[model samples]
Target chain A: MEKEERKKKVKEEAKEKEGRLTGPRVIGRRDVLKGFATVPFLGAFAGAWARKRHIERELKNNLLEVVHLTAEPADIVPVAINSKPLRLGIIGFGLRGRHLLRATGHAEPQWIDDAKASAASNRLDTSYEDFMNQEDLNVVINGVCDVFNIHAEEAVEAGANIFRQGKGGKMGTVPKRYRTYKELIASPEIDAVIIATPDHWHAPMAIEAARAGKHVYLEKPMTWNVPETYELVKAVKENNIIFQLGHQGRQTESYIKAKEAIQKNILGKITLVEVCTNRNDPNGAWVYPIHPKAGPDNIDWAQFLGQAPFHEFSLERFFRWRCWWDYSTGLNGDLLTHEYDSINQIMSIGIPDSVVASGGIYFFKDGRTVPDVQQVVMEFTKHDLTLLYSASLASDRQRGKVIMGHDAHMEISDRLVINADPQSTAYSEKIKQGVIDPVVPIYSFTPGKKGIDGVASATEQYFASRGLLYTYRKGRRVDTTYLHMREWIHCIRAHIQPSCNIDQGFEEAISAHMATIALREGRRVYWDREKEIII
Target chain B: MTKNHHLREYSTFQALMLVLLRVSIGWHFLYEGLVKVFNPDWSSFGYLMDSKGIFADVFKYMATHKDILQAVDLLNIWGLVLIGAGMILGLFTRLSVSCGILLLSLYYLSHPPLAGLQYIFPQEGSYLIVNKTLIEIIALCLLLAFPNSHIAGIDRFFQKKNK
Candidate 1:
């Protein structure tokens, strides 16, 4: 008891002496107090009245609107093309690339005794924690390629570990590093490729991969430009190979349950849907600090830029490509597409009839071309649905992805909630039978609920639930990337469409491009679905 | 299909605005809670000591009493977080808002608008019969009166599953 008190006193005193125990020493008492004083009740009376009027107007207007939507549970089966022991190669060994490697292994490394001394007495944010926790890869990671020397080395090491495990410690099975993606794609030894490169390289590499007859799992925002969208679509179709776009949210259990609820005609007729991107941290924004080691010497500046207009080498541009218009599709393609694809998966929304995007860089004065705050209204004219997306990099808010039907509204995040509409005629029988209350939430589904009981932080869990980190298979915690990758592998062998496939990828690319054009031009962009082009 | 798309858009915008308001308030609460949660040394001692409201002695007592003070601190930080997350996500919103009302009510009473209540601490902006806490309590009341979740957040998801 005395020891505990002493320890507690020391800790408290240390904290009092230094406002923050770690990170930076910028936060003092005055700063903390200032944080408390900063930005609340901004509208004062006008804001209150504005929201009141808005709610009043909304409730009255929303009553008359209803739409019934269906969620098609894609029965993705194998097409009987190939057998097991499917050969796979990976390109791009950055943050996401490393995460994908974790997916290939089964049992997590139970012990990392060698790195324990650096933990500094239960420090959670140890730099080596991620590097140490490696899973034994089951599949044969045959090849690796990266423009950067460090990335390439990491890939080789990670793949070698995986290979050693899969080959039963035969040793000397280091994956032969390729010079370029084209060389890797052409390699007959590799049957499939997971393209985790930047946005600009997605189409170029994918097009090459398709031509080389390698099944591709390209990342999201599948194309660099409008023309590349059609060209990549053509390549995949002509080659007749299984193509999976990396919108891993397709495998997310929360969204899948949301789909089930929607299929049950919960939200009567879906008229409105709102999705968000609220991440209020420095790392959350694309202002990734330039690694001290990343210079022109080790980095491939020309290859990184690819087909984009050339400029002098800047580490900021190379490291944080997502913040720039030259390489990235900006907020519309990078952020909005996630929300769009999720809703599209649930609602099976094709190309929207029209799109109106508006927002600006209200915060983060880091000279990012894309807006920090983004809002887009996508009108699905035929389905009588309007999809609204709101994103902010300045504030962290736990707003769920919402789809509203006249009868009910389906709120999908980590948990799915359906509240019966008081005026919902479709659900009148259930209400009358006391099966559901008109006001209270009718149904709830929390994916991986039991496993997430003692989570360290809400922020981490938020990312986890989105299938960016982890998920559950039969209540057992599993990396969602594994599931997504498994589906891609299964489809490659089974010869079927993976969750986010060619047509869907094309759709996303086209739609994202449309929104991008609208936002860029500051006008409403129309999609001529028949022509398969943005008008 | 016959409905005016513009009207629907306008109404949806207005409705989303309400959700944003709820989100803004939720962000404020959740942000503060999370900041304190991350900061192990954070305590409500200074705020309690500088209490300028009616219940300064009570607040001061709660701050000074080590055992009771720990509970108060835990409840205050976690309470703000829970209510904020609920309001933001529309998950357990009713309970969170109810808890928020209780929390804000305590805050209001601790620093009530009654006469002869003054302390060394400074107040942010001016408040008469209704200050920030009371105003928030009322705002929460308005939000509770008509939760726009069905129109915006997770409640919409739950609303459909029951049907």
Candidate 2:
């Protein structure tokens, strides 16, 4: 009887312990004290450590996948290895060019090791010191000549074997480096030339580079018009020099991963994509800071005015080049191209069938010839999707990209946030009943047909549940300049075409340029894919 | 609430003026706050002086020393949002007006672009500071002079609810 009583007591105690373990336990003061008795700061420490580990794991996974994709060849089945660094030669020593050079891996050699030592010593000064010492590039040569519009003798004097056109080349003064581009291209040591010149000069310089047999890495909004882009594309194809257009975000790891996730249907069938860039500050809207030294004497006045309407050389146009229409494609070509390139890559969108736009020079009453705010809607046939792209020079909210699809919508910025909306009856039913039989396909209700905008509701719920509107920073968000330069180097070594090649660059430029035309003309422009023209 | 048996001459005129006043100021605050919220690179706390220059130093300091700055940034963002919401809704008008003035004042003081004591015409920096803060302060004064919230707002509804 006593033994039976003891066994009953033991079983009752076990039940109590299980309840405390599995169920939400209302701990008394004594129990709380007892919990913390063993390790005073254990809970706090563990929580922090767990969070760090989670973030680190995400970053590591991102790096691993990106490294794999970059190393592997699409043409071949699968060979995964990170790409080797390629050699790069920068021509200009100006601020913009210098920034690009600094970004292209020319910082400190032993910065990483120094960082560890600093961490051990708990010295922030050492950390700063390391950063200063560390270079971001393997090799960077200073003061290369702007071969564009200069005499061939001067180009040779500047030791520029790989000739590049600065803003001066926009006026059509072929640098005297060689009488024709043929001599420049035939140079043995010159492998590639990066044309970081104005819009009008882009096609001329790129064509020259292509003709020379030297690979070309040209800046954004590749050409002036659709016909120009087509011509440039032809030249690139004919020459087959490794051409990389300067939409550097395509080379970024975040963008590559985002693209992969979308291709893998991580966010389901994408239907709507929205991109916005708002700049409250003057500088953000491409109001270039006027250098005190800026004048006709300091700047190549006539050269800067090339192809532009017969406006005299002024400090304003020379310094604030982006604000002028003749010099640039305005905000659409300058800022919107980056957003568009990333959007197309992420959602696998080719050229859009039609583009509708609305814009005007509404703000910055400063003497500028381009619209400060613009919105464009491009409808793509393949995905049956429409992309909404908007930019405001007056406002500051810079929302990156939001892609909406059937199953889930993703708001992509520094990270890819896949949100599962509850209103998605398909998703909800799948969750509740679990995966249905392979033979039984689930039918989804469209927003209009359903009582509620099901997808919208699901998106709202998804955001609410997560206590966040979007997931941020899945991996380290890179400075795109470095990524672009790295790709250039990588292509140089591997003999592979960079992701944002001539064709992609030209297409991106045409897309934006057409939109600008549409907005300016106040008419819907139909892109004739057959003729490769914007009507 | 007492019903107005004696219809006064100034009441209608006063109502029109109050509505107009509230809306204009409310819009100004709303737009200002919204613009800052939208700008991606518009950081609340980043720059601190270094060899690079004032702007670079401020940004570098904020980026490098984020621990304290992050907390401050969160408050600033939410504070602006709340101010915007309050001003636009005309709910707690006086409180919103005072808060707006205080915010502008604090910002002005933090980076005072003031001249020496021979205060003649205010410089551009001073002019900018004074322009925003003065408007916010006037809005506060107006709210105080005539409790606009009580006239036609959530405050009136709340007053009734409490009663």
Candidate 3:
């Protein structure tokens, strides 16, 4: 073995010496700079190239607007429950919290038959007035909490069905209000808690709720920053409690089908996935109007500041908290998390190896800190996959989410469509047999319709429908948030893991923070697996 | 003209000519890429918007979709730099030239020289379905085809050493 190795080395050295003599021995460095001289040469001539084509600025603009190719909500697994009703305490009865409450049980009194009648009446609806009755869900909104007395009052009032005032069923009673989340979570009457506080308060409140032996149904983003992400997940696990992250899009039907396609390897070595958000409306962009009743009196200014920095009572900051970095996680946590978590749910991608994000506060210059436009690229090196997320607040162009694989690509927007790649090796056999045609898609699924079932603007509802935020059953519509809340309630009683459970929530928190850190610091951020943190 | 004869030796003028072509193309890529890198406002947005000829929708799509548009912007900028640097330095000739071919081809296809499409801007020269992008692609093709051309490059020094 040694003799053979010695012989190989001698032959290699001889080849190297021969190689040196044969090639140019002294190539001038100046000769290389001659290459750079072509810049102006190409640049000058490329003009003719640019000018040769007629400009269609508007056509280009029309093409570039955002798309809404999101999937519809999944049907709740129909199962009989023997356990008694679970008491659900809700903290942060802000806009999203109120909606969650309505979806969970508030719309039980209403039905899909009403939405059809409303749609027939030509009313633009975006309310949770039509979801199927989750009568089997063991949940009662017993405790309501918010720093703002008005929000708390509205949350409690939201439970009032005085129309059925004399009836002795679920609609008869209303939840008691609390000023602080601590007071609400500590209550012995509450069996589980739904937290929809500001981004900063999520982890602190979730950790406290877990310690108090309450199951958690936290809203999107899951946590504010990196340490909070770890601590919250730890608390949930250590307490052995069921924790559901509010990426209600997990119930999206196209997402479920897409996940099935991925598990089947129908796309074959999936590589790149792109998800986007585009909204032209003011409310959609996070400049939510400051309420007329908002003030330091009705709102507890100090307590609302919870884990965030203290600021003098500013209604704009309180109502439009999503516009600031101190109280929010910007686009990554606010909007991109939806796409990220949805894609994560389908692909089962835990954490990306690295995240590189870029954006600016383009268009909406309304004293807001978070960028109205943002883009994030996440690389899962182990899976050889890349997740791309782009959000634009100024534009209404709907660039839907698309996942590209070697054999095919799955697009989740108006429908779930899978197209065979013409050059795919995996599909070559089927292609040769004329079984797989590139001209036609291999699979297509349209789960829900573009419905204005609830009392939101057509634009806002378009952005919110399970199809984008509102979901549909047989000829009737349901809310994705309701379906999500239903699954959590069922899982809580059955002692089974919910769809967007604690571990998935942890991965999502880490992923969103990775994007946040990357965008904020203007650098490439990597997940240190051993250390369980982004660096 | 025999393949075996050029393997041992080549004329000095021939080596200079080969190096010249390599350096010029390298410079073109590097300079174009670097200019865009330094200039934040620089984008292919105009080019994509004004795209005509075959694959007009492809060009328009690239211009319209933010994700693809952003990617095209970054890839076009960085890809030019890396491939141009490789060509000039005579490192990874095959890999660099291959990438250059693909990039130039995309550019060529984006707006072909097909007749009947006219615009208001000043055009340098007129040719039927052929232009500078195509010419550069041919130049890159020549660089890739010739193994001995790399003798004028640093790749010669580390040619056998690189794994």
Candidate 4:
């Protein structure tokens, strides 16, 4: 019996050991401690992350207090589209004309089809989507005018595409095609005229439209020469018509912010401003491909010459009129005016006190009179600064617009970036205190980018520095041209002067003319502020 | 129960090293996820748009499609966060490591360090066929192969209860 009891006890002990090894065991302090060992690391991470964020927030707040600019883009007031549709007449239905028409909610069937195909093939190409989503401005093309027969017919078809559809889609009423701009401007059915003609014809078409009591949307440089500049301005003012010069840069969000920054004196004492244009393509150089069917038979060569010097009915002169001084205002009117107007919009630095310009057609030797490259320097003695305008059609090295000040320099494009100067008296104390870094932007404003990124990445900075043809308003990408046209239409209905009014156009025209004179004379030209003349 | 034999074979130093590696990776993922989650404007647009390699078109499509992009952004942010929490807490460690490997693999494929490829976002260090992302992925694989979470994690308690 004793032997049997010992064996049973041994077996029971063995069963207990097996139960300890395979079955659930009671929780011990050591087991609990080991299981929760890594929990402290998570607590440490949270603590460290919070502390780091606090320091960054403090620094960002300090920097923002010093800057005193809003992180969000300026608010855009939505225009009401309740009024009756304005009857429109478009002259010079060429490249720029087609673009302007599309901005005003009219695109040809071919363009619509092509844009759709492109979007389908490449998802990144949002052109078709953006165009289709564009708000429909209440306007109808009542009249169309172009020197070329094909362009006029195309404009008619595009005007009839009210549904914004592709080929074989629904169509609307076709606009009446006028053989001449004067005829289109005189039509009683048209309430407004959009002149997208070559340089020589801008003033004449605008003058006729203004006298006919029709609102005018004229493309830059405003006029081809000095005398016509005065004539166009006087006609528009005398007629009391809404005149909007096509400086779509006026609608850029960065320009608006830049204007505010200047008003706030964020850039201390202004010293110099530099703006540039760089293009490296045949089309950009005015070597536009000649239409095969374009010739004396289809084109109205006589009317096309309008105010331009008489030239043979050559397709080159007719198509690429910007290449010659006879029909074009050279680089000054064609390109420099864009740069000049953008500066004027930002600084309100009207006609410069004096100007000196020089350049030659160094790149393209395609029998063109206008220089393919040019540089113009305008002295703004009143503002205590010098405005430098440079152009290069041979190399597309982007040198963006910059406004320099004693304390800080601002680079403005679709975005604005302000960097404090190292030697700046205003920021030296902050720099020494390590509150500000000269290499980093003190104030960076990217239109669509939310909030302030005090230290934006290099890629962000690069993109911000690059020029964008489109601008953002309220975090939405909008065609600046569309905004400019909408502003003009709004002004016409409201009976108010548009953003780029006759006064602003006068400044733009006189400035461009002074540069052109300086280039042609190979001497410095002075602007007589009192006489309002370039001498 | 037999799996416990290999789990017990790891020396204290070896288990500590494995736990440290897992936590460090978790920290990286957690921080990355939190930063993006806090920033309202953050989007995978730039990264996907800059994608190179054979699957570039597919990634680019995801970036351009608004609904798909939103979904992708949510998935990426939450995936990193949950996977990171799982790794650090040693809860479902195997699953976390597997998910991390998959995420890193996608990143590696999108921006492979091939000889002729260049990226807009400047890289900190020069790389050839191998990069930091690839290294991290390999490390996650190592963790997958030798999981010691039950030894020094919340998994230890659950493991004991199950036994």
Candidate 5:
């Protein structure tokens, strides 16, 4: 009886010890699950922190004008104009302004449907209504600033404030009214001026407008040279007038999103950026449509050559202004400034340290000053970044903006395409032989144990055909024209700088100007930011 | 071993044929396999089903699940390098050919029908699985028939050299 009792006691002790070690298999499964449950919580916390950091970085980098101007809602005062239904004055009644008016008027709402029709088009319509509802403007002046006179009737009909005069100043006077820029800038009735004039006239008109305390929307290539650029900035600051640079790309929602993605490190550390704008014909060289009747009768010749050496009022020079070095800064300031401004806003990289370029007028020898093919390399010191800009008037191969980073490459176009480098087969072979096959348990898994759920075995067969791991993140497409324009207008109302403000515009202009100088001088030109010149 | 008795010897003729066939098959495998092993830019997983339009969806999914593709790539490289070397040398002749056949068969099955049957030729009327897999399968058959050890091979050399 005692022996039986001892055997029972021994069996019971063993059972208790086993229970203590294994912790009741059924109950332990629950505890294991409980421990696993906290994993998601920790993951969520890390994800949120990462997201917060990205948001903070983006906000800091973005030159948000409204945020800088107003903190309290009550401090914001809506501008009141004399005209009913909110007047919009567009000073530069040129090609850009006409397109702007057409886009803002017809496509503003209808563009939404068109974007939805095409998968590649970005969804820019979501914020379009916000622009119309944001503020009540008194007038948007349509000024005569482009190479050709943009019909002011369109602005007038579109419910905008139009300030325009005939080609020969004050309705066909032999010389042209406003021959001296001071007369054009000092027009009292005009509430504001959009300085979309020639490169030389840009600074003088802008400075005068700022001096007159009138809001100004100055087109790109902010000034003719570095000294004038400084003077323009000083004048704007001193007068405390609402000044916005016409680097309209900053207003693009797609660009803004790309910038946000970069600041978020979605692309990791950006090392190289490539921007290419190419065309197959001479028209792409900015030799715009020349009217059959283009002459001194239709163009203000003196104003067109303002501040620059006076030349004969040739129709070819007036219409194809971009092809000449006398009026336009050729390929650099004419086209490159727009790209440079957009890129600076996107990558948040300041002025480049050095710039080198090589280009020649090889293709279009037809009365053009700029090269048919131009390639510029810019090196930035602040972030160890390199940017290359290639523009051609001959080739049609378009390799648009590309931002290469460690993780992925974010390419901007009508739609954004983020891609990873294709895996090397030789490297993969080595990994399979040297590392993965030996280490990964999943790789070597075999059909051994059967699950309790009564599922069939031979599970290893399923694991044999698996491929490598990679992730792709793509955003919804969105157009930027309306958004960029709206952002500019909003900045004006808030008394803050626009997205592509004067500083960004000047830097881009300098970079573009340097590229031209490099090509012209047959030597590399480095940007000296402190000195503000091409060295 | 007289000259007249040699005329009736089927074994000698068979061995001669086998030797010639095995050497030829081994050489082909070695040549193809070595090139893939040494070439740096070769990638297997990157373009499994890359195409325009809807085909992009297939490639995108394949791109995400790459481990298996990677393993297969490694296997192919080694199977060509080591097995091809072994077969060509006739050191582990039968074993090398078997592995080569196995790898070729797996690749054949991965993308069946192997593009088109039309390859480089004077348009000979062909009706067979004449892909890399088929070549390997034929090589394996030839290897099986070969008296690689007794015939001209390193297996015999090693045995003789050591002796």
Candidate 6:
């Protein structure tokens, strides 16, 4: 019995040793503690994140409260309901004319196929998608007119392409082609006319269209010369027709916001505004490619020289009309007018008191009379500001529009950025307290983002400046030209004036003429505000 | 104990250092993922568009496709979050390390530190093919080779149970 008890005790001791070596089958308190050892690190991370977010939120709210500006995009006006489908006519079926037609839901079959092929190869080219998604304005192209037979044929094909499809697709009824703008304007089926002709032809076509009781959408630099600027305005006003000049910058979202900022006095005591245009290419300098098929037989050379000085039937003069002063206002009307109109829309700085301009045909010496490089300075004594305009067709050095003030300066493109001045009377207190950093932007509005940022990164600023970021409204990219045309169509139906009305067109033309005279005459030109004349 | 024979035993200091490294990387990944999740406007579009080097076209192609970009963004965010949580808890740490390495490799390849290349998004510090992302990837590789998660992490329970 004693021996048996000893063996049993030894066996029990061995079992205990094995159990100690293997560890407990069930979890112990010590094991549980070891397993959760890193939980405290997660806790620390949560605490730190929450604290950082809180601090950032507080600072953002404080700065926003001081700035007192909402970063929301302007509300898009909804199309008027129960409006009838309006009839349309297009007069110059050139490059720009086709673009306008496409915006109104018609595109040539060749363009559609090209756009599709481009989109298929390069996914980043959203042009096809954007064009397909554009809202139809419910207007039929009933009449088409062009001096060149090829352009007229293309316009007819494009006008009939209501489906916006590739080649060999179903098409709508072909529009009737007219040999002259007068014939198209007088057509009973046409309710509105779009004038996209040469600068010299803009006023004549528009005036005739206005007198024919048809609404007009005239392309800009409203007139070729100073004399007809008055005549076009009088005809549109007296005829009581809805007129829209093609200053599409009037529909730019950033310009709308800029106007609001000015009204709210965001930039205190604005003193100077600067704008620029830089393009370095053959096409940009008006060395447009002449059609191989174009000649005296296909083009109506006599009708083309409507009010301009007579010129020989040369394809260069016919296709690249902007290079000559006989048919073009050169850089003043071709490019600077766009910059001037954008600034005018934002600041409402009417015709300046005096303008001095100078430049020469430094580049593209292709026997062109127009200057490829030009600079015009206009003094606005009433507003205590000077508007500086500069252009260079030989060098594409991007310089954004800037509006300077005592307290801040704003740089505007498709996005708007305002930086507080280092030495300022308005924001001096905030800058001293470190709440507002002069180096950083005091306010920045980027469309498609949730809210404004007090500080934007260099990448954001760069993209915004280059207009690569947002032409978006509520996450959808929209073409400003489409919007501009829509506005004109709506105004024709509503019997109202569009944004770029006759009055605004008058100011745009006179200002451009003043600059041209200053450049040509080699002296300062003054606007006689009392008599509405350039002296 | 027999199964652990194949695994090298680490000293207390060594184990602590490994755990610290794993947790800090996890913290970084988690924060980045969370920031993207919280900001609705956040997109990889700009970064991919600005991609340089040999794989630039591939990155740009990914950005241009809307559906692919959305899917990529979701996968990137959740991949980071899951990998981060796994690393911190010492669960599935090897898989996390491998995935983290893959992601870092893509980022590095997309924006290689080659001469004559400039990026719009400013970098905090200059680098010559050896940025912080590369260093972090090396650290993760170290963790993969000498893993201590089973010793001091939630992985211990599973490992212990398996034994």
The positional error of residue A234 in candidate 3, measured at the CA in angstroms, is 1.4
List the lowest-lDDT window of 10 residues for candidate 3 chain A. A59-68
Give the best candidate by TM-score.
4
Residue B44 displacement (Å), model 6: 0.4
- Cα deviation of A34, candidate 3, in Å: 90
lDDT of 2 at B96: 77
Segments in model 5 whose C-alpha atoms lie over 4 Å from true places:
A1-91, A101-181, A422-479, A529-533, B1-163
Task: Give candidate 2 misplaced runs (Cα > 4 Å).
Answer: A1-95, A104-143, A146-189, A430-478, B1-163
- Residue-wise lDDT of candidate 4 within A1-535, one digit each (tens)? 9999999999999788667667767779987888888999899989998998898787787677668774233344456678789999999889999989998899999999999999899766767888898888889999999999999999998999999999998999999999988889999999999999889999888998999999999988899888988888889989999999999988887788788888888789998999999899999998888989887889999999987777789999889999999889988888888899889988999999999999998999989999988999999998998999999999999788999998999998778889989989988888899888988888888777666657665665653444221122123467888888988988887899988899999998999889989999999999998988788
- Indicate the worst ten consecutive residues by lDDT in candidate 2 chain A: A444-453
Q: After superposition, how far is residue A298 of candidate 2 from its true place, in Å?
A: 2.9
Categorize the docking of model 1: incorrect
lDDT of 2 by residue, B97-120 (tens): 777777666554444443432222
Worst 10 residues of 5 chain A by lDDT: A446-455
Off by over 4 Å in 6: A1-24, A71-82, A457-459, A462-474, B1-8, B160-163
* Candidates 2 and 6, the one with greater TM-score: 6
Computed on C-alphas against the true complex, the DockQ of each candidate is 0.02, 0.01, 0.03, 0.55, 0.02, 0.45
What is the alpha-carbon lDDT of model 3 when measured against the actual structure? 0.73
Q: Which stretches of candidate 3 lie over 4 Å from their true place?
A: A1-82, A107-120, A123-129, A132-136, A162-171, A432-434, A448-473, B1-163
Q: Which should have the higher lDDT, number 2 or number 3?
A: 3
Candidate 6: tens digits of C-alpha lDDT, residues A207-254: 898888899998888999888889888999889999999998888877
TM-score of each: 0.60, 0.54, 0.60, 0.95, 0.51, 0.94
- State the local distance difference test value for candidate 1: 0.70
Residue-by-residue lDDT tens digits, candidate 1, A1-535: 9999999999998776444323243444644432333123333423664675575445433332322223333564543434446667888877777667655542112112323445444332232344434333336677888888877876876666632232234334578898788788888889888888878888999999898889988878889799988899999999999999888888887787677667767677889998888899887888877778878988888888889889899888887888888888877777888888888888899889999998888897787787888888999999999988888998998577888889888788756656788788987876676555566555544554332211123343334344422221122344457668768877776688888988888778888888888888999999887786788
lDDT of 1 by residue, B1-163 (tens): 2122122344767766666777777777876776677545456655565566557778877765556778998999999888776777666666777888888887787777656666344555766766777888898887776566544454433432110
In order, the first chain's TM-score in every candidate is 0.75, 0.66, 0.77, 0.94, 0.63, 0.94
Clash totals in order: 23, 31, 33, 0, 26, 0
lDDT of 4 at A285: 94
TM-scores computed on chain B for all candidates:
0.79, 0.63, 0.87, 0.95, 0.63, 0.93
